[model samples]
Target: MLPTLDARLTAAAELVLPGKPVADIGCDHGKLTAVLAASGKYPRVIGADLRPGPLAKAEQTLEHAGCKDRVELRLGDGLSVLSAGEVGTIVLAGVSAQTTWEIIEQAPWVSQVGGPRLVMVPATRHSELRRWLWEHGFALAADRPVQAAGRWYAVMAAEYTGEVRIPTFTECLFGRTAEWPEGAGYAAWQKAKLPRFRLGVPDGTELAEEIDKLLDGSPSQTR
Candidate 1:
């Protein structure tokens, strides 16, 4: 039997481009890793975790899937387990936005020309992650909204563009997902969190008003 992925992981996997090696960073049970390897799309598949327990579970998952020899499991922190250009796609799932940013930030090579693609599913702070990526020279190539276990999540695929720009609050919140089938639910979920996000910012009032107009079906001034 092959490993199976939930709706969230399935969306992440779909965003992966073919023809190059792929790495599942923080690969907990390696279900996604096993699936990727079984697909035979990429030349190589790697599963890396920071802890021994998760990596062990990942090993078991790969073994059961009969693709154990197809995946390389590494024990290391973040992207340190692999060298630059080793993989063309890097997956970071089931982690907080802050944690994902920290991992990508540490691996500057992913921002260089011809860097690997990034497929991320941030457990929290999705808007913040989009903004961070935009300001750091990474561009959101695409995004898909998916619901799993009764919660809506966005799976974003980004690539290094080396063009840093300030994104509007609305753009940060939406991130090319406004047209997806589950986009409305994800947007509403993000809208509900704006109140808390506004509490600590200096331009809270303006930002909140702008985001409100955009989310309320008003024509957005900024894309």
Candidate 2:
């Protein structure tokens, strides 16, 4: 029997288009790569990792699943190993927003003409990543908050549209949940965390005000 995908990986898989080539960065055990290969939705799947040990593990997992032929395991950091237009979509999950932002900033080719789509799930600070995407010529195509392993995660799918638009404070924090109903839970989750976030920051009053307005059923006023 094949290994099952967790809710998070399932969300990532659903974002990929059929027949498109995909690169799975930080593919720890190659589970996502193997699943993508088996689905026959992607023509090819590249499983990349910075360490050889994880690449070896990915190889083992792929071989065990009899999907070694469909997935090409590569050992490299970030997107350095991939060439321009090598794949039409890239997945970066289980990483911090800061790290994901750095990877995207370094790999400018991913935003060039006919660049690959970006499918990311930041383990923390999702607002930073969303704001960065808007400023970097990418458009948010889809965003969903999925409940996995008793935790909430934000799944963001974006395309390089070469159009720049600054995201408002509300969109940065809650995402465009008003447009994508799937993110309502995520918005509420973020709303609940605002108190804790306010405790640590010196200028937490702004966050408190936002939360207060939200609780009072008023639209968030941009800061």
Of the candidates shown, which would achieve the greatest TM-score relative to the real structure? 1
Q: Estimate, for each residue in 54-159, the C-alpha lDDT of model 2 and write its tens digit.
A: 8998898888888899888888899997998889899999999999989998988888756888889899888889899889898877777788988888888988
Instruction: Spell out the clash pairs found in candidate 1.
Output: none
TM-scores, all models, native as reference? 0.92, 0.90
lDDT of 1 by residue, 1-223 (tens): 7976899999999999899999999999999999999999999999999999999999999999999999999999999998998999999999999999999989888889689999999998888999999999998888888899998888999999899999888887778887687877877777777667666656557876785565467434233
Residue 20 error for model 2, in Å?
1.9
Q: After best superposition, candidate 1 residue 166: deviation in angstroms?
A: 0.3
